[model samples]
Target chain A: MSRTFYCRGQTGQQLLLGAYGALCRQVGLGRVKMFPRTEMLDLVVAGGRARGIVTRNLVTGIVEAHTADAVVLAAGGYANVFFLSTNARGANATSIWRSYRRGAGFANPCFIQVHPTCIPRSGDFQAKLTLISEALRNDGRVWVPKRRGDTRSPDAVPENERDYFLERMYPGYGNLAPRDLASRAAKRVCDHGCGVGPGGRGVYLDLTAAVAGLGEKVLCERYGNLFEIYERISGENPLHTPMRIYPAPHYTMGGLWVDYGLQSTIPGLFVLGEANFSDHGANRLGASALMQGLADGYFIIPYTLGEYFGGAALGEVSPSDRPFVEAAKEVEDRLARILAVQGKRTVDSFHRKLGAILWEHCGIIRNAAGLGAAVEKIRLLRAEFWENVLVPGDAADLNQELEKAGRVADYLELGELMCRDALAREESCGCHFREEFQTACGEALRDDRRFGHVAVWEHAEQEREPVRHVEPLTFETIIPAERSYK
Target chain B: MKFTLFIWRQRNRGDRGRFVKYELNDADPGMSFLEMLDFLNQRLIERGEEPVAFEHDCREGICGCCGMVVNGFPHGPEKGTTVCQLYLRHFQEGAHIHIEPWRSRVFPVIKDLVVDRSVLDRMMRAGGFISVPTGSAPEANTVPVPKEAAEVAMDAAACIGCGACVAACPNGAAALFVSARLGHLGLLPQGQPERERRAKAMIRRMDREGFGACGNHRECEAVCPKRISIRFIARANRDFLKAFFVHPGKA
Candidate 1:
């Protein structure tokens, strides 16, 4: 059996505060200067190394440059490219996307993790989906109505008529199945018109049996906050009725390619946390992300960074240098281009369209035909975005629309690249599930001999196809084994 | 659902902000407050108008990046709920909602509903953490903490640092916010050595940042999205009083 640690339902939040406290202490000691209310637009590479970054002040909207010895991007992942992901509203791929454009190798862009137990999207106007902690799966039984198109409430459905799908499919793991498998199973059932909740796009996560077995008091001690959150959002009590959950893009295992020292393909550019495509392979176990982030930030980077600083032959750099000035100008021009569009459709309208295309074709499952069509559709949509996307705000102000427009523009390109990556990988391995390459029982068929390598893509110039590079994997310690839940 | 929103609008930090009236006729009941605002902004953008600028990161309410006052309530009328989690269903159809930024002298408006909350970070920087060696993860059970103490610390640690407490306080005091951190660190065994230091330094920084002293109005406790009790403030005050005699100015 595996074990995990948590702080109730707020582990992520508590960990963030701890990290923020450490950062603030450094800021207080004058060791670190935090540039809050500022968004990075581009990475500054001088003499073939990352020297600084260009940022637009979110308050003033003025593009400026800051030079540094070694730039570390803890900028986070691009799961937001899916648009209705569990990521923050401001969470975008702009930082890493710009870095990719500047020569960082983006590895496995298609390996996006869709969490199984997220609060289902209520409507098209939903800003972001909330994730119900996976830990609840230990106590909650996942189910759906056996009868298709059954509109009865969860409590009203008879026990025999209910289909405990996870328990039936993978009897060994039951509700505790891995995220990718669980998410796909939920999708498969929903596709068969067996989904519960709103728009018939969710399954029931019933904790009633667990609560009855372990008493409400015991359950409350463990998941009180989560239950409260569920009630507040969906207006249904999990203790009284089962929670309706659906799969939503929660994390990305694909990011900037890094070596053993966490340095990206670009020298002097260190990537950390979810931003780097290190640690978690294609599918991540729950609570491991926190461990990986803490390990990188607290344990690993310090020594590696010290070694880098000690070994590198560096020169004095200034903000007025050619690279810095050029990067700033590039950022300014992009912002201006977005603002100058002044088209009929809103930036969000384009984002929603892009999200729909990605979700339908390149989501939990993928096929060559659908992916190829998606590529063509995205190309057309991106061109239209440049031509007709309305960004009605001044470039030199705290304009939310302008900020969104810039991020969406990057996503438009990145979304196409993600589809391209998905199309190129023919094997059904990890989260990149190619429908044509799966087993008879719907399990992902891994082709280790043919596809056991990281598909790293290099950004080509505009309107040109990106070149793909492979880093072959060699297992030295252990033999590769098939993952089975049966 | 439809509603008339009076949202604060400011071009930049220097502009005198004013509430701009917007009629959102097609807001769905299932939309969160932020999503409703997004719909409003989308319409405004289509109309060739600059959208209202509000700060939001995680719309799931954990990030503390989203904050705005709604109809005189800090995070709307929902108890222990952030504005991002507040749904349109909570409001009456065609409700006239007044949205504004956190009103505090220290938290000056950057633009519209976005305020500069760096002061809270400044106060935390004074002393919000326990000093530990930066290295590999330490062995578990090295320091056994009391169960009750850990529980209290966890409760205090739930603070999201959204500054709603400061915005809700009648005196514009950050006692609740500061006290939550103080209690979170102070109640732990690892936090013992610097306990007195933390209280004095954080309270001193609070005073230095031009925050008013708590007057026991309990307005802060009323609007805290996490429902952090004001009892943490009492604990912090006790620590601060003791800190005055123990470690006076060094921290």
Candidate 2:
């Protein structure tokens, strides 16, 4: 597996470069027209099918209509809704949410993957978090102070007293365990005051033995960029300091719900990559995110799209068509509304406050009471957001504030639905851990009879009132059992 | 902890940018440079003013979408740091910082502090690739690359396409970015078949895009966020020269 997939620490980048290179090649050959920095604003639906889109040329600030036979959304994830996430800064849920408003279903959105090993958030000013890839766990052993709130240097913490918790609990997998399992273990220990670092929410991922076994140069060859990123962020070299890591919102498994062929609830509207909730039920496995993205783009979309095109192309529509104009007007009107407010609070201020609520209630741990409470709070926040979001700039130009306000507006709505979904599920499974549904031994207890179904949510006008349609899970071969890392 | 920042401000692509000073009273020292901008932007909204626009994504420095000239240095004062990772801790208590966008004719200003980087993508479009069709490639281990060669390829592959090299270069050259891509693919066995063709096509495209030739000024490596060395430029020089002599003679 190491030789087959690992392209050092840059596998994702390498694969993307290959794909981007191919796309760029098509652009150069005049085979595929590339809109360099255009961002999608809304979907144009006609005759109960998605026919085109409204896009803003980010450079020129021109909103244009692009009528197409199909609208494919590979527009990343919603992890950025969590202020301190390991997603690209521009990655947002606006595109998916717009499609949802145009009548698409969002599925399992509460199943957000929290990474076990991320550079701990330094302060309130952090724009985005960096992920120390799980591959480093192949050599590094995770540990913390056996005694809670120990302040001594790591060198002084004796080996006998040190709690290598991952190694202690799961002898076989240890630090190399799956993402959700590792994140839960770290959180569990931290909850007990055994966590290290400034906020006492971090555990040490030590690499002493790894450096000894495989020379520093070898590791440098493989993970030099990651190590450098760590040092730059934390101001501590991993060669000496055990990396202080805490769980962070890395990926969101839930997205616009799609069928087996990768078509969304809307006809002619396709979804892929992290945008579509297709593969990796509940939690994703290591190396699978990139695999899924590449597979969807190269294999699945081509075949499925070909099949769709074989049926019929959309009716002839121009930029001034009724559907295109209506979609364009909808986008322009929203932007105008955001600008007209001229209210007190910034979009980010409201966003930060909303993030704290969701993180405290719906994040990591959830319960009926907490989830229900979060939904109510989200409603108030959403109301305040529209009334006082303070989107300063007008819609006449390229306003960064306008763009963010729109994304945050969508997040405020999506946040409520996520909590409602969490509240609906009575059983704990995968990354969706409801506190009331846990077993006596502290493992996630699944209720296969009642809760074994995908809760597909249709967006309703009012917050906390999304209509849910259940798609029950049917296991073909593997039987459901306890997940015992021990 | 507060400071005065002279940020570059432009209303639109056509608007001429100028330094607009603002007093940033609120901040956390731990925030990355972009986070500092986020703080300032939040304040700008409170003041009923438009926030300065800058290009950024994947603030962890992987995407190469973010760039700025800070205090006369590309990506701030820190070495091997993108503007996104440059923390406030590196600055003094009351530092008066000058922030500007990348200065290049080819990469024109789109808005305040944001430039059109479509040219770099165009350079990549010219040739930066292996010609293998999807799903037709053999087993990964089929091509046995020596460890040293693989390591070198990884080192060269670390370029994020950030265009810092072009911004920092006195001649506004994109040689470093092109060389890094060239070095990454040209060293590997899989990239050998189209090495000559790749070199010619990419070089021609860079010239056509109006990027200046490499003037051997090492400012590119000095200000590069990824700290990619200029050795790849030397490698690209060799590839281009060899391709020159061989292209017409081959047929």
Candidate 3:
């Protein structure tokens, strides 16, 4: 049903470079003026329409306002909310979160993708997890010890004793099963005390069978770079033994809700790429994020944006407008307040704690009780973060701590919203696998009749619960079918 | 494992930077270099001292936002590893690691280990991309490209624009970086329309940005996290010379 075009293991890199080249050409022509090292603090909405944005000059720490007739945001996803995700350290929900607060509807906050293949967290000091390409699943067979708490070396574990869970559970797909399914399966096995490696958190991705069949040279040629990277970080060569991998937050399917026109609730405000929750209904297919992003930028936006412009009338808007000034001031005061909190805990400490709270309750498999507990814990954590977090730096300079503090504060709020959304969506569907709603085989059970609508949450005032609004999904030609690999 | 760290601390671009020493007693061998830095920063923040400001994104080494000098190596002593991907096990226990920002006149230190590598972005803007029409997907096989050319283009496109080449260069030259950008687009048939203009503008912008001439020291390739070859520099020079002969008026 799907086809993939790739250049070795560097598909994402090649595609990004191609896009970057085009952007640079425009920049060279003086058509695009880039503001590097700048962070968007707030979205400016004047006259009930999106107009501009307030950004902090990261170099000088100056809060500046930039107004435009139309604003297009493609600021990426918020997988970093987990603290130890496969996302960049700088990746945050700030831009989209600020937009949500400024009237954009955030849809499906709980629909986050947990990638099956990632380097397992080594220690408490581990900052972020690295993702191994899904291509490894083609040859690498995922397995764990047949006995619970088996401490023997991976190679020492006899072939018969190794329980190949993926192949056992989903014989049709095996290791190549969908990310959400595989991730959930791994968690299920680990929860049952059958996990391998450190702290019983990982499973063996054994490629010995494939290597023996294909030869070491062929295996090396296929995934040489990945193998090297694995060895570099874990200090364990995959060729010698099986690789230890665990599920980690890789992407967020939830983002600022946008319509067919790629425009959010606010007029003149367009969202694209992963920033907009337009594509990938519940789970994302492999290599599709890039394709969707390219389509949004290169095709969809060109037409839809023009259509938006054609419909709207000309309004004289300037960066010195009242809305821009107020937004800029708001950003500045928030920064000042964050700096004023000269408390004990570091931003990283709070972020790590928040990550733990979410990962424990709202991660992989969630239940109503745990989600409720998570929401309460996050609320308390957010309050503690505001009052007790130490951001030791001035607002008038390039302060990474201040940036992180603001982002973490936003994540604290977003984390609660995620729990709330997850709690509301009672039935299991795709990545949102509720413990109470799964089938006998522990597969996601979708409640189409009652919960087939897209859960869109609108931001309410401080200390008030967000208003949940739904848009019913109507299937016309193609009927929604239950996914089964077995 | 215990290790002493000498970290560069700069308040801002105008501030004079100094090396601050701190002893870390609980650095795990499993922790990445950046994780170790994060551990140190957490300690500093808890002590009411400002944490080090470093630019890091996509710790997987593809984003190219993280680059620093560690023990006189661009990304530590590793052959082709970024600071984010470099692990503590690679270093000896109780080693006094000297960490600093990328040393380049063009890339002024903003605060601590964070440097203004926007110059590289500027160079990219000059002539890095192929100008294409934005619309629906173009039909594949319309313009046939040589298999070899496509492969070479991919190799050139692997540059993360981390500015490590400039930082490691003895003359602070961005020849390797610029050439990688040039080679990525120039080898493609789609890039042929504005190829000459791209080469001239990008090379001129590189010189204008105060980047020194390549001294053939091969330092950039040696320190590059992506292991981008210096051969791309030669490829860029060939394109530059052709552009120079073709468009003498622009020169």
TM-score of 2: 0.95
Residues A1-486 of candidate 3 have per-residue lDDT tens digits of 212322455777766776676676677777888787789999999998888899998778899999888899998999899999988788889999999999899999999999999989888888889888878888889999999998999888898998999999989888889999899889988989999877899998989898889999988877878898899988988987899999999999999999988999989889998888878988888878988887898778989988888988859899888999999999999998998988888888899999999999989999999999999999999999889989887887778888899999999999999999999998999899999998897788999999998999999987789999999999999999899999
Each candidate's DockQ score against the native complex? Answer: 0.77, 0.71, 0.79
CA lDDT of each candidate? 0.88, 0.84, 0.88
Output the worst ten-in-a-row residue range by lDDT, candidate 1 chain B: B131-140
Candidate 1 vs 3: which has more DockQ: 3
User: Interface RMSD, candidate 1?
Assistant: 1.3
Q: What is the fnat of model 2 with respect to the true interface contacts?
A: 0.77
The regions of model 3 sitting more than 4 angstroms off are A1-8, B136-140, B249-251
Residue A178 accuracy (lDDT) in model 2: 72
* Chain A (alone) TM-scores for all candidate structures: 0.98, 0.96, 0.98
Sort all candidates by DockQ, best to worst: 3, 1, 2
Task: Kindly list the per-residue Cα lDDT of model 1 for residues B1-68, writing each as its tens digit.
Answer: 88888889877678887888888788888888888888877777777777777888887777886889
Candidate 1 local distance difference test against the native: 0.88
Question: Whole-model lDDT for model 2 versus the true structure?
Answer: 0.84
Winner by lDDT between candidate 2 and candidate 1: 1
Model 2, residue B128: what's the lDDT? Answer: 90
Write out the backbone clash pairs for model 1: none
